[model samples]
Target: MYYTDRGIEELEGRRGEEEVSFAWLSDRLRTFTDLNPEFETAVDRLATWLARLDDDEDE
Candidate 1:
């Protein structure tokens, strides 16, 4: 498994049962990017990808 999968698994194990809104997730992403400026582009890309997941045009 990929190294990142460990973090993903840890997240799932820690908070999988919690329900959160996109707004909440967005805020958390923003906070993370604020603290980790180097990851800004990656966070933005992830946000855009999540935002477009339901768009047929993107597919």
Candidate 2:
């Protein structure tokens, strides 16, 4: 397993049963960037990748 997989697993394990709105996620991401400026780019990339998942799926 990759190092990042631990973080992913923790996320899934902790919140897998929860359902959240885009606004909630956006706010969370913003807060994350505020606290972790260095990770902003990775978060941005993840958001962009997620935003385009549908487009990719249709291809």
Task: Point to the candidate with the largest TM-score.
Answer: 1
lDDT per residue (tens digit) for residues 5-59 in model 2? 9999999999999999988998899999999999989999988987888997688
TM-score of each prediction:
0.92, 0.87
Question: lDDT by residue for model 1 over 1-59, one digit each (tens)?
Answer: 99999999999999999999999999999999999999999999999999988898767
Q: Model 1: which ten-residue window has the lowest total lDDT?
A: 50-59
What is the model-wide C-alpha lDDT for candidate 2? 0.93
Counting clashing residue pairs in each candidate, in order, gives 0, 0
Residue 38 of model 1: what lDDT? 100
Q: Which stretches of candidate 1 lie over 4 Å from their true place?
A: 57-59
User: Candidate 2 versus the native: TM-score?
Assistant: 0.87
